[model samples]
Target: MSSEVGTEALTRRGLMLVLSSPSGAGKTTISRALLKEEDNLVMSVSATTRPRRPGEEDGKDYFFVEPVDFNLMINRDELLEHAKVFNHYYGTPRAPVETALSEGRDILFDIDWQGTQQLAQKAGDDLVSIFILPPSTAALEKRLKTRAQDSAEVIAQRMSKASEEISHWREYDYVVVNEDVDHCLAEVKAILKAERLRTRRRAGLIDFVNRLREGY
Candidate 1:
């Protein structure tokens, strides 16, 4: 009698996680912290019509495109999700994200609530969303001013928008109160770990379980 041993293989699958927050809510800081700590995670590069910031790379920080190209992409249905922020259009391209997921790589998204809603419609199963909130509106305003990057007028506008942004917190799958960066990072780590172990993420779990039952 010939018998074959059932080989157990570890396969990776992709995840689409979004981290959204109002200005000065620490979403970008948390995202950087996550990337530094999580070796296997990558940030999704969004395409934008805005000019590149100093020291920002073309593809790393964002896929900088002209207004014409961005409008063309919208017409072609190439964006998975997109939004207009401060009069500039920004969007996540469909092709790169699809390719990354198919190849078993996890992608991180830093977008607003509008984009998150659109993303969920397109990638419901693979999507996990987290929204960050400042300890208080006053604290949020303080943080935004600490950076001193924007003019007083612009800061006022952002402060106004913050209220609207925070109103959508219930729409996210997870809501994180970023009172302390270290503590919040720990919370995010736990969230990711738990989500990674979800049954749906294990595409081969059923077959693997069957093999064990059969003693193969």
Candidate 2:
């Protein structure tokens, strides 16, 4: 068993993990924690027409672009998925994702329900989407208020949108309740580990196993 396990570890592919949540959920925090803990994971930077937020650096938080340029990308079929939220356009570009896949690097997406739908259409087999939910509506609202980043009116609006977003939880392959950040991060990490070991992702495994059986 030990020798077989060692051989299996030598043949595995990386994961394409998508983590999504509503406005005040802890998806971003969990994603960042997972990235910090795992060397093989890379955040898939998204392109958007929205202005950069305070403390956000270009190409780090998002790839900010003009509306016209964003539309050009849409027309060229260059985006894997895109959507308009609060009058701003956000999208996942196709090139970088493919590059990461080819390089055997795990790509993480911090997107919304609509973007996840588009990603499923574009990378159905390779994608493993997980939706994170706050433990309760009260807890979610509390989180929003605690952040203090948005006004009361805005927080109310987000809470409303969160209801609609939560409706799409069943669309994801995995669902996680984020009551604790550390525990949720561990759940996501376990999912990524399992996804990486999936047989479909290890396309060369059969040939390798055959070689092993042949005593070469």
Best by lDDT: 1
Estimate, for each residue in 1-216, the C-alpha lDDT of model 2 and write its tens digit: 122434554555555788889878887789878989999999888899998889998888889999999999999999999998889998988888887786678898888888889889999788999999899888899888998878989998888899899999999999999998888888888999888888888864776676666764
Residue 36 local lDDT, model 2? 94
- Candidate 2 residue pairs that clash: none
Clashes of each: 0, 0
lDDT (Cα) of model 2: 0.86
Residue 102 local lDDT, model 1: 72
lDDT of 1 by residue, 27-101 (tens): 888999999999878999999999999999998989999999999999999999988878999999999999888
lDDT, residue 21, candidate 2: 91
Which prediction has the highest TM-score against the true structure? 1
Residue 7, candidate 1: C-alpha displacement in angstroms: 9.6
- Report the Cα lDDT for residue 141, model 2: 92
How many clashes in candidate 2? 0
Global Cα lDDT for candidate 1: 0.87
Candidate 1 segments exceeding 4 Å error = 1-8, 51-55, 149-152
